[model samples]
Target: MGIRTKLKRNRTQKKGMPPGSLVYIGDEQTEEVTVSAIAFDSHGMEEFEDVSIDKIKTLIDSDQVAWINVNGVHNVQLVDQISKKLGLHPLTTEDILNTDHRPKIDFFEDHLLSIVKMLDLSAESTDLDIEQVSFILMENTVVTFQEKRGDLFDPVRLQLQESKGRIRKSGADFLYYSLLDVIFDQYLIIMDEMDDRIAELEGMIMEDPDNHSLQDINQYKNTILQLKKTVWPVREVVNKLINRKVPYIKEDISFYLQDIHDHIVQANDMVETSRGQLYGLLDVYYSSLSMKMNEIMKVLTIVSTIFIPLTFIAGIYGMNFTNMPELSWDWSYPAVWIVMIIITGLMLVYFKRKNWF
Candidate 1:
């Protein structure tokens, strides 16, 4: 879901449902579920789109590393069918169908099930687009289920197609690491974008702090929080892999998985730093507003002070009193005007020397 879209966990609908119920708990998805498979050995590679279940099974049994990518898991029947065919545990299937699942790793007897959040920053704004993705690691095959079509795995696919990297020569666990490596790299990319945004916000606050800037700062705080929540659990997932908790993940592949852990740690640190900076920005924003108010009040007070004596003089003359001696003199009015001008000039000089305005 994009940041602008309100997130809702639809598990309430499953309140009375059975424990192993196949319910979709995310945004409404109407798109058709599509499957793609990539089978490759060190010698060659083949790609299939809209592949059948039987074809996927064949590739899984072949002497190669098979990657089956299933997009759009909203269809409960289709997901149940695919899970049953692949022999995924019912609990794993339940987690896969629940898009609200946090980033976690579950070890099963035959397969290693991992859930993670895929994050992408929208191009139009700082809003983040997040989706839950699940990966099942088997002996010779790695199956990835996504909430929808499109992913950050294009580069991995390209490398596999061209046989341009060590991925082709590696096992299924290595391929799983390669896919996760893409996600970790994406985390960094999003972090870099956020860093740029923080700098931009700092500049904006310094130059012209306003309500909109405050709003943006608050929005970023929420985004950073979400990022932190997602990245931390992923760190744990990689830590488990590094500790050799999943038997299907080879030892050498575990070494590569350490890189993912390091990346997650770095990303989490960046998130923490950004969060602090945003809070600092909020303080600066309020301070700027206060200073502006002080300046405005200072100007008004000076104007009112300058007019105080003038108003008093006017008020005295405005009184209707024929008994006053100065009212009978011809030059009294001119004399009063001169006296008032002199008083105003003297007051101005005193204020200038005091530097009160």
Candidate 2:
């Protein structure tokens, strides 16, 4: 089963609910809250430690670029407070709480709202763990929300800290792009691993077809199908962002979004390729099994052929009614042995000549 079905979201809001309604969209268990802020402009950058909600407002109004990263989304009160302060719409808030949503981008009056699934492949089992991350991008500020704190944004943070690229000079839109780029890059890595696994399984199936190998191939096919469900929608989401004009997206940065769109295309292509490879694997498995069965039948037929005449000779000797001329002869036992040996040798030679063994 896909993770979406297993980790489905429960709606807490009523129908016709007003905008900005507070609802929690994560697991029931709550944990400690952690907030980190990075405020940067063309000239310099500052990292704030242990910042409170009140302190966040101070940076939101500044002309300098700012990025507010909230690690935990379990606190409804904190999430509500941030929504109220920033004047975010209720629908946007609802999406943040509804973590089961596919990747999407929505345009608001002053910001562009983007939602994406972050994937982590288990090193031990090669299974996938998916999480949802939401982004709210404005002109000078960007806010990111995740279910828990981990390495999802570590690459983006490193880029900011080292000023490795033009991240420091870029606006919040570029920061938004950076975060998405990192997430999609992870997807590529996971796809590569999946490709390797499929290739290995293909080799095993060709070498030996067994019940275990068939089961493994089916499991891999299921995994790839589930992954396709997530990736296809994401491609459409990015495509919408690239073609549609939104206030938050600058004209200059449209190309960057287009680049992300291209990555989505690449991911989709890999998914299709994986599907084809799996089908080819199934074909190979069936053919190998058929070949093995034919070999076993051939050996059984040869054994049965060699035993038929020997069984007949024994039967004739056992039916002693004194009327059997050969049984009455003085050298009958030795002659019967010689005849049996000759028959067996002839059958063996014929089988060898026919290439049946």
CA RMSD of all predictions: 2.7, 2.8
Q: Model 1, which residues run further than 4 Å from truth?
A: 1-10, 245-247, 323-349
TM-score of each: 0.91, 0.89
Please give the lDDT score for candidate 1.
0.86
- Candidate 2 per-residue lDDT, tens place, 288-319, comes to 99998999999998888988998999898998
Residue pairs of candidate 2 with colliding backbone atoms:
20-90, 25-97
Q: Which portions of model 2 show Cα errors greater than 4 Å? A: 1-9, 12-21, 26-30, 325-341
The TM-score, computed over Cα atoms with residue i paired to residue i, of candidate 1 is: 0.91
**Candidate 1 C-alpha error for residue 297, in Å:** 0.8
In angstroms, the error of model 2 at 194 is 1.2
Top of the candidates by TM-score: 1
